[model samples]
Target: MTSTLTAPVQPETVHAIEVGVMQDRIIPEPVGPPSYRASYVTRDTAPGKARRGVVLALKTWGLEQLADTAELLVSELVTNTFVHTDSRTVGVVVTRTAETTVRIMVLDTDRAEMSVPTCPSGDEESGRGLFLVAALADRWDIERVSTGKRIWCELDTKKVQP
Candidate 1:
Protein backbone atom coordinates (compact mmCIF):
# COMPACT_ATOMS: atom_id res chain seq x y z
CA MET A 1 0.00 0.00 0.00
CA THR A 2 1.11 3.58 -0.74
CA SER A 3 0.01 6.90 0.76
CA THR A 4 -0.03 10.37 -0.80
CA LEU A 5 1.52 13.37 0.97
CA THR A 6 -0.35 16.68 1.31
CA ALA A 7 1.15 20.12 1.00
CA PRO A 8 1.22 22.50 3.95
CA VAL A 9 -1.19 25.40 4.11
CA GLN A 10 0.32 28.77 3.33
CA PRO A 11 -0.72 31.94 5.09
CA GLU A 12 -2.42 34.59 2.96
CA THR A 13 -0.26 37.57 2.10
CA VAL A 14 -1.66 41.13 1.87
CA HIS A 15 0.06 42.26 -1.30
CA ALA A 16 -1.08 45.87 -1.13
CA ILE A 17 -1.48 46.91 2.49
CA GLU A 18 -1.09 50.67 2.34
CA VAL A 19 -3.94 53.18 2.48
CA GLY A 20 -5.73 54.02 -0.80
CA VAL A 21 -9.11 53.65 -2.53
CA MET A 22 -8.01 51.07 -5.10
CA GLN A 23 -8.16 47.39 -4.22
CA ASP A 24 -5.02 45.39 -5.02
CA ARG A 25 -3.24 48.57 -6.10
CA ILE A 26 0.27 48.80 -4.67
CA ILE A 27 1.26 52.18 -3.24
CA PRO A 28 4.78 53.04 -4.15
CA GLU A 29 6.89 55.27 -1.93
CA PRO A 30 6.29 59.00 -2.36
CA VAL A 31 8.81 60.25 -4.88
CA GLY A 32 8.56 63.98 -4.28
CA PRO A 33 7.54 64.63 -0.67
CA PRO A 34 7.01 62.73 2.55
CA SER A 35 3.58 61.35 3.40
CA TYR A 36 1.84 60.90 6.78
CA ARG A 37 0.17 57.69 8.00
CA ALA A 38 -1.23 56.33 11.29
CA SER A 39 -3.34 53.36 12.45
CA TYR A 40 -5.63 53.10 15.48
CA VAL A 41 -7.46 50.28 17.23
CA THR A 42 -11.26 50.55 17.28
CA ARG A 43 -12.60 52.04 20.52
CA ASP A 44 -15.39 54.22 21.81
CA THR A 45 -13.21 57.30 21.42
CA ALA A 46 -11.61 56.34 18.11
CA PRO A 47 -13.15 59.16 16.07
CA GLY A 48 -11.77 61.90 18.27
CA LYS A 49 -8.42 60.17 18.56
CA ALA A 50 -8.13 59.71 14.81
CA ARG A 51 -9.11 63.33 14.21
CA ARG A 52 -6.35 64.58 16.48
CA GLY A 53 -3.79 62.38 14.75
CA VAL A 54 -4.93 63.58 11.33
CA VAL A 55 -4.83 67.21 12.40
CA LEU A 56 -1.28 66.79 13.60
CA ALA A 57 -0.20 65.03 10.43
CA LEU A 58 -1.76 67.67 8.20
CA LYS A 59 -0.06 70.43 10.11
CA THR A 60 3.26 68.63 9.97
CA TRP A 61 2.92 68.32 6.23
CA GLY A 62 2.30 72.12 5.96
CA LEU A 63 -1.31 71.62 4.94
CA GLU A 64 -2.72 73.57 7.86
CA GLN A 65 -5.32 75.29 5.73
CA LEU A 66 -7.05 72.01 5.10
CA ALA A 67 -7.19 71.11 8.78
CA ASP A 68 -10.82 71.95 9.57
CA THR A 69 -12.36 70.19 6.59
CA ALA A 70 -9.97 67.25 6.85
CA GLU A 71 -10.65 66.86 10.54
CA LEU A 72 -14.39 66.78 9.97
CA LEU A 73 -14.06 64.26 7.15
CA VAL A 74 -11.75 62.00 9.13
CA SER A 75 -14.06 62.10 12.14
CA GLU A 76 -16.98 61.03 9.98
CA LEU A 77 -15.06 58.11 8.49
CA VAL A 78 -13.82 56.89 11.86
CA THR A 79 -17.30 57.17 13.30
CA ASN A 80 -18.68 55.10 10.45
CA THR A 81 -16.15 52.34 11.12
CA PHE A 82 -17.05 52.02 14.80
CA VAL A 83 -20.77 52.52 14.29
CA HIS A 84 -21.23 50.21 11.32
CA THR A 85 -18.57 47.50 11.38
CA ASP A 86 -17.58 44.71 13.76
CA SER A 87 -13.97 45.60 13.17
CA ARG A 88 -11.55 45.52 16.08
CA THR A 89 -9.21 48.11 14.62
CA VAL A 90 -9.01 50.81 11.97
CA GLY A 91 -6.22 52.27 9.90
CA VAL A 92 -5.96 55.99 9.06
CA VAL A 93 -3.69 57.24 6.34
CA VAL A 94 -3.10 60.79 5.01
CA THR A 95 -0.99 61.28 1.95
CA ARG A 96 -0.12 64.37 -0.07
CA THR A 97 -0.42 63.06 -3.59
CA ALA A 98 0.35 66.32 -5.33
CA GLU A 99 1.23 69.93 -4.62
CA THR A 100 -2.47 70.69 -4.30
CA THR A 101 -4.04 67.41 -3.31
CA VAL A 102 -4.28 65.22 -0.21
CA ARG A 103 -5.82 61.78 0.15
CA ILE A 104 -7.31 60.31 3.30
CA MET A 105 -8.31 56.67 3.80
CA VAL A 106 -9.93 54.70 6.62
CA LEU A 107 -9.59 50.91 6.57
CA ASP A 108 -11.65 48.50 8.62
CA THR A 109 -12.35 44.74 8.82
CA ASP A 110 -15.96 44.00 7.87
CA ARG A 111 -16.28 42.91 4.27
CA ALA A 112 -19.88 41.74 4.28
CA GLU A 113 -21.24 45.03 5.63
CA MET A 114 -19.82 47.30 2.95
CA SER A 115 -22.25 49.62 1.15
CA VAL A 116 -22.27 52.70 -1.03
CA PRO A 117 -22.55 56.09 0.62
CA THR A 118 -26.05 57.51 0.79
CA CYS A 119 -27.61 60.87 1.44
CA PRO A 120 -30.16 61.36 4.18
CA SER A 121 -33.13 63.67 4.09
CA GLY A 122 -32.61 67.09 5.63
CA ASP A 123 -34.79 66.23 8.61
CA GLU A 124 -32.95 63.04 9.42
CA GLU A 125 -30.26 63.14 12.06
CA SER A 126 -28.25 60.14 10.87
CA GLY A 127 -27.12 58.74 7.47
CA ARG A 128 -25.47 61.98 6.47
CA GLY A 129 -21.87 61.01 7.14
CA LEU A 130 -20.97 59.86 3.65
CA PHE A 131 -23.02 62.59 2.05
CA LEU A 132 -20.87 65.16 3.79
CA VAL A 133 -17.75 63.29 2.72
CA ALA A 134 -18.74 63.43 -0.92
CA ALA A 135 -19.70 67.07 -0.76
CA LEU A 136 -16.48 68.21 0.85
CA ALA A 137 -14.07 65.85 -0.87
CA ASP A 138 -12.90 66.57 -4.38
CA ARG A 139 -13.28 62.87 -5.16
CA TRP A 140 -14.07 59.75 -3.15
CA ASP A 141 -14.26 55.99 -3.68
CA ILE A 142 -14.30 52.66 -1.86
CA GLU A 143 -12.04 49.61 -2.09
CA ARG A 144 -12.78 46.07 -0.97
CA VAL A 145 -10.16 43.66 0.25
CA SER A 146 -9.80 40.10 1.51
CA THR A 147 -10.40 41.27 5.06
CA GLY A 148 -12.62 44.36 4.70
CA LYS A 149 -13.05 47.65 2.88
CA ARG A 150 -11.45 51.09 2.77
CA ILE A 151 -13.32 54.37 2.29
CA TRP A 152 -11.14 57.07 0.83
CA CYS A 153 -11.52 60.72 -0.17
CA GLU A 154 -9.26 63.20 -1.87
CA LEU A 155 -9.26 66.94 -1.17
CA ASP A 156 -7.90 69.75 -3.27
CA THR A 157 -5.60 71.47 -0.82
CA LYS A 158 -5.21 74.54 -2.95
CA LYS A 159 -7.09 77.63 -1.93
CA VAL A 160 -10.45 77.96 -3.65
CA GLN A 161 -11.17 80.81 -6.00
CA PRO A 162 -14.20 83.01 -5.60
Candidate 2:
Protein backbone atom coordinates (compact mmCIF):
# COMPACT_ATOMS: atom_id res chain seq x y z
CA MET A 1 0.00 0.00 0.00
CA THR A 2 1.13 3.52 -0.78
CA SER A 3 0.19 6.71 1.16
CA THR A 4 0.26 10.27 -0.18
CA LEU A 5 0.45 13.52 1.85
CA THR A 6 -0.53 16.97 0.66
CA ALA A 7 0.77 20.30 1.96
CA PRO A 8 -1.76 22.45 3.86
CA VAL A 9 -2.97 25.61 2.22
CA GLN A 10 -1.52 28.81 3.56
CA PRO A 11 -3.82 30.65 5.99
CA GLU A 12 -2.78 34.08 4.72
CA THR A 13 -2.14 35.10 1.17
CA VAL A 14 -0.82 38.48 0.18
CA HIS A 15 -2.98 40.51 -2.17
CA ALA A 16 -1.74 43.27 -4.41
CA ILE A 17 -3.82 46.24 -5.31
CA GLU A 18 -3.00 49.05 -7.70
CA VAL A 19 -3.76 52.59 -6.55
CA GLY A 20 -3.67 55.54 -8.93
CA VAL A 21 -3.11 59.15 -7.99
CA MET A 22 -4.47 62.07 -9.97
CA GLN A 23 -1.93 64.44 -11.50
CA ASP A 24 -2.68 67.99 -12.62
CA ARG A 25 -1.42 69.31 -15.94
CA ILE A 26 -2.78 72.13 -18.03
CA ILE A 27 -4.33 71.02 -21.28
CA PRO A 28 -5.11 74.40 -22.85
CA GLU A 29 -4.04 77.75 -21.51
CA PRO A 30 -5.77 81.10 -21.59
CA VAL A 31 -4.29 83.87 -23.68
CA GLY A 32 -4.58 86.61 -21.07
CA PRO A 33 -4.95 87.37 -17.38
CA PRO A 34 -7.69 85.66 -15.38
CA SER A 35 -10.83 87.66 -14.72
CA TYR A 36 -14.15 85.99 -13.90
CA ARG A 37 -14.62 82.60 -12.20
CA ALA A 38 -17.48 80.16 -11.65
CA SER A 39 -17.61 76.67 -10.20
CA TYR A 40 -20.24 73.95 -10.25
CA VAL A 41 -20.44 70.82 -8.05
CA THR A 42 -22.75 67.93 -8.79
CA ARG A 43 -23.21 64.18 -8.62
CA ASP A 44 -22.40 61.80 -11.47
CA THR A 45 -25.65 62.39 -13.18
CA ALA A 46 -25.95 63.74 -16.73
CA PRO A 47 -23.72 66.57 -17.92
CA GLY A 48 -26.43 68.63 -19.59
CA LYS A 49 -27.38 70.37 -16.37
CA ALA A 50 -23.84 71.42 -15.69
CA ARG A 51 -23.39 72.65 -19.26
CA ARG A 52 -26.51 74.80 -19.05
CA GLY A 53 -25.37 76.29 -15.77
CA VAL A 54 -22.00 77.20 -17.23
CA VAL A 55 -23.58 78.71 -20.33
CA LEU A 56 -25.78 80.93 -18.20
CA ALA A 57 -22.91 81.94 -15.98
CA LEU A 58 -20.74 82.85 -18.93
CA LYS A 59 -23.55 84.76 -20.49
CA THR A 60 -24.02 86.73 -17.29
CA TRP A 61 -20.33 87.48 -17.23
CA GLY A 62 -20.60 89.02 -20.74
CA LEU A 63 -18.81 86.14 -22.42
CA GLU A 64 -21.39 85.57 -25.13
CA GLN A 65 -18.88 84.57 -27.80
CA LEU A 66 -17.86 81.74 -25.56
CA ALA A 67 -21.44 80.74 -24.77
CA ASP A 68 -21.98 78.25 -27.56
CA THR A 69 -18.47 76.91 -27.50
CA ALA A 70 -18.45 76.74 -23.74
CA GLU A 71 -21.70 74.81 -23.68
CA LEU A 72 -20.40 72.26 -26.14
CA LEU A 73 -17.05 71.98 -24.40
CA VAL A 74 -18.68 71.57 -21.02
CA SER A 75 -20.98 68.88 -22.39
CA GLU A 76 -18.08 66.91 -23.81
CA LEU A 77 -15.96 67.19 -20.67
CA VAL A 78 -18.78 66.40 -18.25
CA THR A 79 -19.99 63.54 -20.41
CA ASN A 80 -16.55 62.04 -20.47
CA THR A 81 -16.28 62.13 -16.68
CA PHE A 82 -19.75 60.70 -16.05
CA VAL A 83 -19.26 57.96 -18.59
CA HIS A 84 -15.67 56.94 -17.91
CA THR A 85 -15.05 57.68 -14.23
CA ASP A 86 -16.66 56.21 -11.14
CA SER A 87 -19.80 57.67 -9.64
CA ARG A 88 -17.97 60.40 -7.77
CA THR A 89 -18.64 64.08 -7.44
CA VAL A 90 -17.75 66.18 -10.51
CA GLY A 91 -17.02 69.87 -10.61
CA VAL A 92 -16.52 72.48 -13.32
CA VAL A 93 -14.78 75.85 -13.32
CA VAL A 94 -15.26 78.60 -15.89
CA THR A 95 -12.77 81.42 -15.80
CA ARG A 96 -12.65 84.57 -17.83
CA THR A 97 -9.25 85.51 -19.15
CA ALA A 98 -8.75 89.02 -20.41
CA GLU A 99 -11.92 90.69 -21.67
CA THR A 100 -12.38 88.44 -24.67
CA THR A 101 -11.33 85.01 -23.53
CA VAL A 102 -12.79 82.31 -21.30
CA ARG A 103 -11.43 79.04 -19.99
CA ILE A 104 -13.61 76.04 -19.21
CA MET A 105 -12.40 73.28 -16.95
CA VAL A 106 -14.07 70.00 -16.01
CA LEU A 107 -12.77 68.13 -12.97
CA ASP A 108 -13.38 64.47 -12.13
CA THR A 109 -11.98 61.69 -9.96
CA ASP A 110 -10.48 59.87 -12.94
CA ARG A 111 -6.73 59.37 -13.16
CA ALA A 112 -6.51 57.87 -16.62
CA GLU A 113 -4.81 59.85 -19.35
CA MET A 114 -7.14 61.58 -21.77
CA SER A 115 -6.95 60.87 -25.46
CA VAL A 116 -7.63 63.39 -28.17
CA PRO A 117 -11.18 63.30 -29.53
CA THR A 118 -11.76 61.24 -32.64
CA CYS A 119 -14.66 60.12 -34.76
CA PRO A 120 -13.89 57.01 -36.73
CA SER A 121 -15.17 57.12 -40.32
CA GLY A 122 -17.42 60.00 -39.35
CA ASP A 123 -20.09 57.34 -38.93
CA GLU A 124 -19.33 56.32 -35.39
CA GLU A 125 -22.11 57.01 -32.95
CA SER A 126 -19.76 58.15 -30.18
CA GLY A 127 -16.28 59.66 -29.65
CA ARG A 128 -17.05 62.91 -31.47
CA GLY A 129 -17.40 65.15 -28.44
CA LEU A 130 -13.77 66.10 -28.26
CA PHE A 131 -13.79 66.87 -31.93
CA LEU A 132 -16.39 69.54 -31.32
CA VAL A 133 -14.30 70.91 -28.50
CA ALA A 134 -11.32 71.21 -30.79
CA ALA A 135 -13.28 73.00 -33.48
CA LEU A 136 -14.89 75.48 -31.12
CA ALA A 137 -12.10 76.09 -28.68
CA ASP A 138 -9.01 78.09 -29.49
CA ARG A 139 -6.99 75.52 -27.60
CA TRP A 140 -7.71 72.58 -25.31
CA ASP A 141 -5.89 69.98 -23.20
CA ILE A 142 -6.03 67.88 -20.03
CA GLU A 143 -4.54 68.61 -16.65
CA ARG A 144 -3.63 65.87 -14.19
CA VAL A 145 -4.86 66.41 -10.64
CA SER A 146 -3.96 64.93 -7.26
CA THR A 147 -7.06 62.69 -7.29
CA GLY A 148 -8.39 62.97 -10.82
CA LYS A 149 -8.06 64.97 -14.06
CA ARG A 150 -9.22 68.27 -15.42
CA ILE A 151 -10.38 68.80 -19.02
CA TRP A 152 -10.04 72.39 -20.15
CA CYS A 153 -10.52 74.64 -23.16
CA GLU A 154 -10.22 78.31 -24.08
CA LEU A 155 -12.59 80.28 -26.28
CA ASP A 156 -12.97 83.80 -27.60
CA THR A 157 -15.55 85.65 -25.53
CA LYS A 158 -16.38 88.03 -28.42
CA LYS A 159 -15.89 90.94 -26.09
CA VAL A 160 -14.54 94.21 -27.42
CA GLN A 161 -10.83 93.86 -28.00
CA PRO A 162 -8.71 96.28 -25.99
Candidate 3:
Protein backbone atom coordinates (compact mmCIF):
# COMPACT_ATOMS: atom_id res chain seq x y z
CA MET A 1 0.00 0.00 0.00
CA THR A 2 1.21 3.42 -0.95
CA SER A 3 0.11 6.64 0.62
CA THR A 4 1.20 10.09 -0.38
CA LEU A 5 1.06 12.72 2.31
CA THR A 6 0.03 16.13 1.08
CA ALA A 7 -0.65 19.41 2.81
CA PRO A 8 -4.11 18.30 3.93
CA VAL A 9 -2.72 15.17 5.59
CA GLN A 10 -0.22 16.08 8.28
CA PRO A 11 1.01 13.89 11.11
CA GLU A 12 0.54 16.63 13.69
CA THR A 13 -3.14 17.17 12.82
CA VAL A 14 -5.08 15.64 15.68
CA HIS A 15 -8.64 15.47 16.91
CA ALA A 16 -10.38 13.64 19.69
CA ILE A 17 -9.78 9.92 19.39
CA GLU A 18 -12.14 7.45 20.95
CA VAL A 19 -9.23 5.22 21.98
CA GLY A 20 -5.47 5.24 21.83
CA VAL A 21 -2.36 4.76 23.85
CA MET A 22 -2.42 7.15 26.77
CA GLN A 23 1.33 7.40 27.22
CA ASP A 24 4.59 6.29 25.70
CA ARG A 25 5.26 2.60 26.23
CA ILE A 26 8.75 1.19 26.29
CA ILE A 27 9.05 -2.52 25.50
CA PRO A 28 12.41 -3.27 27.23
CA GLU A 29 12.88 -5.91 24.56
CA PRO A 30 14.83 -9.02 25.44
CA VAL A 31 18.31 -9.83 24.22
CA GLY A 32 17.65 -13.11 22.44
CA PRO A 33 14.97 -14.90 20.47
CA PRO A 34 12.08 -16.22 22.57
CA SER A 35 8.83 -17.78 21.51
CA TYR A 36 5.76 -19.70 22.65
CA ARG A 37 3.07 -21.70 20.89
CA ALA A 38 -0.25 -23.31 21.73
CA SER A 39 -2.97 -25.14 19.85
CA TYR A 40 -6.49 -25.40 21.14
CA VAL A 41 -9.85 -26.83 20.17
CA THR A 42 -11.85 -23.77 19.26
CA ARG A 43 -14.70 -23.14 21.65
CA ASP A 44 -16.32 -20.35 23.61
CA THR A 45 -13.44 -20.40 26.08
CA ALA A 46 -10.73 -20.35 23.45
CA PRO A 47 -10.31 -16.61 23.57
CA GLY A 48 -9.68 -16.57 27.29
CA LYS A 49 -7.27 -19.48 27.01
CA ALA A 50 -5.35 -17.76 24.26
CA ARG A 51 -5.09 -14.61 26.32
CA ARG A 52 -3.61 -16.58 29.18
CA GLY A 53 -1.11 -18.21 26.88
CA VAL A 54 0.02 -14.87 25.50
CA VAL A 55 0.32 -13.40 28.95
CA LEU A 56 2.46 -16.32 29.99
CA ALA A 57 4.68 -15.92 26.97
CA LEU A 58 5.13 -12.21 27.50
CA LYS A 59 5.92 -12.71 31.13
CA THR A 60 8.33 -15.55 30.50
CA TRP A 61 10.19 -13.49 27.96
CA GLY A 62 10.38 -10.53 30.33
CA LEU A 63 8.17 -8.46 28.10
CA GLU A 64 5.45 -7.75 30.61
CA GLN A 65 5.17 -4.27 29.19
CA LEU A 66 3.36 -5.76 26.20
CA ALA A 67 1.04 -8.04 28.12
CA ASP A 68 -2.05 -5.87 28.08
CA THR A 69 -2.05 -5.10 24.37
CA ALA A 70 -0.70 -8.46 23.28
CA GLU A 71 -3.23 -10.46 25.21
CA LEU A 72 -6.11 -8.40 23.92
CA LEU A 73 -4.95 -8.89 20.34
CA VAL A 74 -4.57 -12.60 20.87
CA SER A 75 -8.02 -12.90 22.35
CA GLU A 76 -9.54 -11.01 19.48
CA LEU A 77 -7.80 -13.10 16.85
CA VAL A 78 -8.54 -16.42 18.51
CA THR A 79 -12.17 -15.55 19.09
CA ASN A 80 -12.59 -14.72 15.45
CA THR A 81 -11.44 -18.20 14.50
CA PHE A 82 -14.18 -20.12 16.29
CA VAL A 83 -16.89 -17.53 15.97
CA HIS A 84 -16.56 -16.81 12.28
CA THR A 85 -15.19 -20.04 10.87
CA ASP A 86 -16.10 -23.70 11.05
CA SER A 87 -12.66 -24.69 12.24
CA ARG A 88 -12.44 -26.83 15.33
CA THR A 89 -8.91 -25.87 16.24
CA VAL A 90 -6.85 -22.71 16.52
CA GLY A 91 -3.10 -22.34 16.73
CA VAL A 92 -1.38 -19.36 18.35
CA VAL A 93 2.26 -18.46 18.21
CA VAL A 94 4.10 -15.65 19.94
CA THR A 95 7.64 -14.96 18.88
CA ARG A 96 10.03 -12.27 19.97
CA THR A 97 11.79 -11.46 16.73
CA ALA A 98 13.98 -8.55 17.76
CA GLU A 99 15.10 -6.53 20.69
CA THR A 100 12.00 -4.38 20.38
CA THR A 101 9.52 -6.24 18.21
CA VAL A 102 7.22 -9.20 18.86
CA ARG A 103 5.02 -11.02 16.39
CA ILE A 104 1.80 -12.91 16.97
CA MET A 105 0.14 -15.33 14.62
CA VAL A 106 -3.22 -17.06 14.84
CA LEU A 107 -3.81 -19.96 12.47
CA ASP A 108 -7.07 -21.75 11.75
CA THR A 109 -8.31 -24.34 9.28
CA ASP A 110 -10.48 -22.10 7.17
CA ARG A 111 -9.79 -20.47 3.84
CA ALA A 112 -12.48 -17.88 4.21
CA GLU A 113 -11.95 -14.28 3.30
CA MET A 114 -9.44 -12.43 5.43
CA SER A 115 -10.74 -10.28 8.25
CA VAL A 116 -11.40 -6.65 7.50
CA PRO A 117 -11.07 -3.56 9.68
CA THR A 118 -14.02 -1.25 9.99
CA CYS A 119 -15.22 1.88 11.72
CA PRO A 120 -18.06 0.87 14.00
CA SER A 121 -20.69 3.26 15.25
CA GLY A 122 -20.87 4.24 18.89
CA ASP A 123 -23.92 2.06 19.57
CA GLU A 124 -22.62 -1.09 17.86
CA GLU A 125 -20.57 -3.49 19.88
CA SER A 126 -20.05 -6.57 17.75
CA GLY A 127 -18.10 -5.16 14.83
CA ARG A 128 -15.30 -3.56 16.79
CA GLY A 129 -13.01 -6.56 17.25
CA LEU A 130 -11.03 -6.21 14.04
CA PHE A 131 -11.10 -2.49 14.37
CA LEU A 132 -9.39 -2.81 17.69
CA VAL A 133 -6.83 -5.12 16.13
CA ALA A 134 -5.99 -2.58 13.48
CA ALA A 135 -5.95 0.19 15.98
CA LEU A 136 -3.63 -1.37 18.54
CA ALA A 137 -1.26 -3.43 16.46
CA ASP A 138 1.74 -1.71 14.94
CA ARG A 139 1.29 -3.87 11.89
CA TRP A 140 -1.22 -6.61 11.02
CA ASP A 141 -2.02 -8.84 8.08
CA ILE A 142 -3.68 -12.05 6.83
CA GLU A 143 -2.63 -14.63 4.33
CA ARG A 144 -3.60 -18.01 2.90
CA VAL A 145 -1.81 -21.03 4.24
CA SER A 146 -1.91 -24.67 3.20
CA THR A 147 -4.31 -25.70 5.95
CA GLY A 148 -6.12 -22.39 6.10
CA LYS A 149 -5.29 -18.78 6.75
CA ARG A 150 -3.14 -16.99 9.24
CA ILE A 151 -3.83 -13.62 10.75
CA TRP A 152 -0.82 -12.06 12.35
CA CYS A 153 0.26 -8.82 14.02
CA GLU A 154 3.34 -7.18 15.45
CA LEU A 155 3.72 -5.02 18.51
CA ASP A 156 6.87 -2.98 18.94
CA THR A 157 8.16 -1.41 22.11
CA LYS A 158 10.99 0.91 22.89
CA LYS A 159 14.04 -0.24 24.80
CA VAL A 160 14.51 1.56 28.10
CA GLN A 161 17.65 1.51 30.17
CA PRO A 162 17.12 0.52 33.76
Number of the predicted model whose TM-score against the real structure is largest: 1
Clashes of 3: 0
**Full candidate order by TM-score, most accurate first:** 1, 3, 2
How far off is residue 90 in model 2, in Å?
A: 1.3
Kindly report which residue pairs in candidate 2 clash with one another.
22-145, 23-144, 23-145, 24-144, 24-145, 25-143, 25-144, 27-141, 27-142
List TM-scores for all candidates, in order: 0.75, 0.66, 0.74
lDDT of 3: 0.78
lDDT of 1 at 51: 85
Pairs of colliding residues, candidate 1:
none
lDDT of each structure?
A: 0.77, 0.64, 0.78
Instruction: Return the number of clashes found in candidate 2.
Output: 9
Regions of candidate 3 where Cα sits further than 4 Å from its true position:
1-32, 159-162
Cα error, candidate 2, residue 22 (Å): 21
lDDT of 2 by residue, 72-152 (tens): 788888887777777355666677755666778787777766665556676778877777778778888887879788788
